[model samples]
Target: MTVTESAQKPEAPANEEQPVVYKSNLEDFEREADVRLPFLLSYREVKLLGIAGVGFFLDAYDLFIINPVATMLQYRLYGGNELPANLEGFVKAGANIGSVIGQFAFGYSADYFGRKAVYGKELMLIIFATIGSICDPTGAISPSGSLIWLGVWRIILGIGIGGDYPMSASVATDRANLRRRGTLLSYIFANQGWGSFVGSLATIIVLLCYKHTMEVDGHTSKVDGVWRILVGLSLIPAFGTLYQRLTLPESTRYAEAQKAAQRVQDEESIEQLKKKANADPGVSEKTKHSSDEEGSGTQTPTVETATAESQSVKAAKELAHAKKGHFKEFFAYFSEWRHLKVLLGTCVCWFLLDIAFYGVNLNQNVVLQQMGFDGSEGTPWNRLFKIGIGNLIITALGFVPGYYATILTIEKLGRKWIQIQGFLMAALFLGILAGKFYTLNTPSFIVCFAFLQFFFNFGANTTTYCYPAEVFPTRFRASAHGMSAACGKAGAIISALAFNSLTKSIGTPAVLWIFVGCCIFGAAFTLLLPEVRDRDPDVVYEQELRERERARH
Candidate 1:
């Protein structure tokens, strides 16, 4: 009998408790609630998010480390050789291009497979690449050839950093509960601040300690070990978190999806059996015939009990199947998938925001010099140390506190509003800095620089990373984030490669204007996204789907 018929059939006595029969279609019921995973998660959730957060730390370290290292390379690696402006651009752009590739490749692959399969593998790839690049020798190489090697390995490193974006973002999204998801995700992302701060600190320590003994640019120097030490430092976080990630559970949503898919298959088989029994009387009659050869005959206790037992198993399996869909199963999320628009929009915003954010950040060194921070004029060691300290100070004053503040308040404020306001703030500051760069002296310039960095973190940087993982459905959440993050990395590449040349040719003020423009565009684009704070991930899709259905009708 169908569920409707079963539900309508009868009721038991008041004193006797009855089984709660779920008479709804499996699809309809499954849509309503996914079962919690078999294992306990509250404690494990914290551990898993921590593992992912560490990935962001390494990612931040590797990315910002380039700034200090670039200065060191300009003096040390190229042999105080004047690096042609064009070659300098290529060297910088290499890693960002690689990041774009890694993000897209790993991200799509993770979505196609399981999140657990892709999680820690990227970090290992980074470790090996870092080791290989460090081992590169300059003995037989021309300046161009050496740069090619540097760019190649940087690309390799970029891939690993790129992969971290989706893996970490999606993991946090998958593990967090609805009530505090934004808060948790922001915490995971805030590791970038520490990464930036530490990168600067590492550069400072290496430069200061090595300052007196070395020779470069016709002077005594302190930056001989700078390249090797800075690059090697990234390995610490990679090794520290690898083992912990291996032990973490695949997300409960993933587990539930897998279980749900299995149940559906089982229910279909049972339904098929019932159909065959009805179709061929000879096959079914062997058991049911005992109840009635004629209409007048009644079901015996033995026969009724057997039929009831079989029906009970079938119902239980259906219930189980409806509750947890398969994690690996690819539900056609765009066509048959109801929440495709939101996913598409979220991904696009990440791409747009990244192009602007990275373009500005990647070329910040040029801005530093334009603002009169030319380390080339001072004692080489003293110059590098000053620049490194500046990086550390800006990171501490701007990124660290802004990120922690976001983590504390995201739940109360909401993700959409925060992102919208963040983009606007970043745009506003960039505009101010662009207009003032020519007019401001050192003190005012420093203040504006600090303000721009602060507002960028306090506003857009925190939200762009947080929103993607929050918006997508569990099945494709990582993949979607990967795509968006990859788009952002593409922006990073544009910034890295072109920022120097753009500044050299067009001037620093124009470059700042470009960033300001990107920020403005980002702010305008963000207005389209739905507000998602304090909302459940599972139900968000359903709510979006319903809105579409209502529109259609």
Candidate 2:
């Protein structure tokens, strides 16, 4: 028997009379197949998940590389002086603005077209944009000119990053087995943590190696090379997976559904021809006469006539369904209370999560410095190792393990409950940081930062990404995630633009307190969402859509 055939074999019920409701169609299979949670992926599922996961790591690496590189740029380009504040804010917000545009455009495209078309194009955009930004004319170009040029390139880069939100999530969702989808999907997003960890480690190693030439002007001129190297490293993963992506098969279930739709259309057309034949006097009379010639034959339409009429009816029903499926599908997701509520709860939680999450990450350097992660006032080598190696340690000890744990236990703890706990914990930690900022010394500060990072990964960071992709229906999943991620990115942009200034003006305590509030709100909002750990994404979504459609009548 085939794998699917094996999967289809059902267990006998304790009570023999209880009937099994085996799935009759691809939609049923699509939903039921996605929930596989135990362990081990099919070879095809693993390949797709790996490609999608790698995309996430690149996204994380690119986003985090700027953290250390920004300091280097200030020293090299601005002559290690206090540069204008507006320029600093502009630099931080450039990519974020681009991300918003990318999410909406590509998210809708994935739904309208297909996931495969949009999947790898983002990586190409990123590779080219990064190259452009690295080679931007530096010497003769005015600051404004460079700003405009860099900003434009960053926006392009943002588009690629934004596109990944829908493309990666949708691809993973499409390929995943239903039972363990949350676990499998979680593994893909876990790369972001690893990416951050690797970026930090790499930045430090590069700085240590190149420390000999480092100068502390407003910008570190020598560090530009390191930034270029950092930007270029992401290309490796992008290119490595490009081949697999080229050969990757579209989701079998999706293909089957499309084929079924096509077959229904073909059958309908043949039926229409039969109906026309049966309606003609000549054909009808001939069919009747032939039927009568068969001894004792009852007066009935000929087999061809009957087949054609049946086909035509089936075809008409299918066409009508196709037409009604379009507008009704979209309207059902929003017009209904249950679905609208789920969507709202998810979007709002994401909005709140991002406010805290991005605010902290955007200002991690400040926290690092506050915790005395700034290398000794002496050698660039020593400072680089301390910050870089510290980040590597966190990735190894904290992020990697935390993510793997989530993946292993998502079935047990459940996505909703886990997320609730994570948000609450994040809130609690932020509260601690806020309460302790002034009173805590270096070690205590480091401890707090570590704790916050732990929960951020273990809780909100990982689950926020996973849940949005899962909760929304397949048809709207990409758009919902795109909107949520875009909203989150917007929060990040706001944090990036305002974080430093806010920390400077109001102090770290106050800034952290704000994050605490957002986290608390996120935690509270998690209660509003359903515990969907057991549900298959596509099935749950389609069923919900169908129910909503029925209610409208």
Top TM-score prediction, candidate number = 2
In model 2, state the lDDT of residue 2. Answer: 12
Q: RMSD in angstroms, candidate 1?
A: 9.4
Write the residue-wise lDDT of candidate 1 on 449-527 in tens digits.
7777776777778888887787766656777787778767766666666676677899877887887777777777677
Number of clashes in every candidate structure? 12, 30
TM-score of each: 0.77, 0.80
Q: RMSDs, each prediction? A: 9.4, 7.3
Cα lDDT of model 2 by residue, 1-553, tens digit: 1112111213445874343322323455455455654555655456656778886797778777766665555555676454467765666677778888988888877765556666678778877888887876756787556656777888898898888888888777765555767877888888888788779877876776676666343223666677778777777887888766555545543333333334434555556656876889787677667657754433545545656777657645654454334344557557888777777777778778878887877666666677666554544445545766655655565567667777887878888888888888888878988897778897777766677777777777787788777787665678778887887787788777777878899987898899888888888888878887866555554354345435643
Per-residue error for 79 in candidate 2, Å, reads: 1.9
Candidate 2 lDDT at 248 equals: 52
Error of 1 at 380 (Å): 2.1
